[model samples]
Target: MQTPSAADLLLAWERGLDQSPTRRALSLLEACLPGVTLDRLAALPIGMRDTQLLRLRESLFGNSVAAVSECPDCGERLDVAFNTNDVRHMSVEKIDAETMEPQTQAHQLHTGGYDITYRIPTSSDLLVISTADDIEPQLALLQRCLTEVQQNGIPVQANALPDSVIAAISKDMANADPQAQIELGLVCPECSYAWNALFDIAAFLWNEIHAWAKRMLHEVHTLARTYGWREADILAMSARRRQIYLELAQT
Candidate 1:
């Protein structure tokens, strides 16, 4: 994906304002990775999509990701910080080192007299499950990813399989697509409560963009009012230059 310019991100944020979280992330990818169709991006395995979003976060902010959560036992605030590489754990080819592209591959699971072939989930799979009111979302996702199912060397339906086999599929999927989910282990200093926190790079990156766009817009307002500069001209200035000009405007 191409690195997004400030103006490009601003446009993406605006377009994503009214969208759901899934669609919001798609908006960012669409703006940054031109020539890639939105449908193709949506079809990307969730981990690959997240890898791209993580790259975007590193580019716009930095490698360090700082976050806060409350302890469940004591309600104490826990501050967590880590580097981007922490969550980037997957096979080198599965997640390309140079291009950061994800390779989607089908995997096999043989257990409880069942043999199953499945692929990692994509954003499109999530969208389909989200809109299906008649089925359990998790079950729907599992069935959607199941490319083939067999029992006793005979073809079988995924839903007919035992829950144990279903769980095996889930576990294998997690292993195959490590970047799709990230959990941070945290221990509260007060109560010593320990728990795992889920980290979503797409949400995290969007929030950073949201805060930055607000600050930049405020700076633009200040400069526009002070010197009658156009929005385009204001956005064209380097961030450091904008900060200097804002300081001058205030003075």
Candidate 2:
């Protein structure tokens, strides 16, 4: 995927303003990968989809990612800095030419007198669970993921599985797809407390894009007022040229 032009960025930013987080992320991906259907992209395993987003993020922004979160124990804010290489636990092999689908290893686990075969949860799976309220979301996720489940050499219902069995499946699923949920080790200097902060790349990237769009709009406003240039003209200028104009406008 190539870096988005100023027009593409602004168009995406405007379109994503009223969209849900999932929709916003999908829009960004759509911008980078033209001709790829959203349904096909959504069908990819969450980790696989995130790997693409991370790559796109690195291409558009940079490799370094800085984040801040409050310490649950003491409410102290902690700053964490890392690179894209740190959280990337999975790699995409070649895409299938005929199907255009990414190849991934299916994971299996044997526990609690049962054998389970499953694949990592896809964005479509998460979208389904996001609307579920009848059962626990985790259990719903597990049920959706179970491709095959056998107890005592006989097939058993996934919904009827015991809590212990479900817990085991959860642990194994997490191990198999580490990129699904990224947790950061954070320490608070003020209170000597530590906690794991959930790092969501989609949300983090959206926030950065939103902030950038707002700042760009402000710059356009200032420049337009001073020189009567159109928004498109201002955005079309290179970042260096825009900075120079902004500085000159400040005088």
Candidate 3:
């Protein structure tokens, strides 16, 4: 069986983004895997996606990626080198199937002085959230996604819930699951300035793709110049043979 290539996974994600253009662009740049359904992609663990993207970038580009940042306090600029292999080796906790169900009842009960339940956001929940037009609707959708059941005797309705009730539910759900939150922290070594860094997966993946394309293009150019070969022919050469040709050309 042929293992799925990075390109194949990328294409699948692209095809899955029919409802939202923002999501489509995000998926392409993030290099998110194609789920069985569009909703499943949203609930996917962010760390898992980050790990996969890093591995894919390394396969296409090189191991080392330069990360540049500006210090928030002193306006000092710094460049940090990150190894894709190190990222690949980092441990990520996966959400189990037992906690995958939506928490509709819990949120409804929380409004009536009952305890609420919450679960990690899944790819599907993200899809629903992304489609929401306003903050209230978004909160409602989130509540519906996270609320598993209510400790109170009140019955939960998956549909026909009011906006205010949904907001309350979302708040209760968020309070229940601290682990669902994603954080990016950065500390400045010089000034001791601390800031929450924005780690955008889409932007990172796009940078990797652009870098890989440029490097491959450069290799193709070198091969064509040295051997008088067509671009297509050069690209078709095995990576090992290409390296050997490049070495021979230099000598």
Candidate number with greatest TM-score: 1
RMSD, candidate 2, Å: 2.3
51 in model 3: Cα distance from truth in Å? 3.7
Which wins on lDDT, candidate 2 or candidate 3?
A: 2
Candidate closest to the true structure, highest lDDT: 1
Error of 2 at 181 (Å): 1.9
lDDT (0 to 1) per candidate: 0.85, 0.83, 0.53
Kindly indicate the candidate among 1 and 2 with the higher TM-score. 1
- Candidate 2 residue-wise lDDT, 10-118, digit = tens: 7888999998787788888877877688898887777677777888889878999988888788888778899989888854344553343878677788898898888
Tens digit of per-residue lDDT, candidate 1, span 34-145: 7777888898888888888887888788899889988988889888999999888764336544443457677888888888898889888988898899988878998899
* Superior by lDDT: candidate 1 or candidate 2: 1
- What is the model-wide C-alpha lDDT for candidate 3? 0.53
Q: Which 10 residues in a row give candidate 2 its minimum summed lDDT?
A: 91-100
Lowest summed-lDDT stretch of 10 residues in model 1?
91-100
- True-structure Cα RMSD, model 1: 2.0
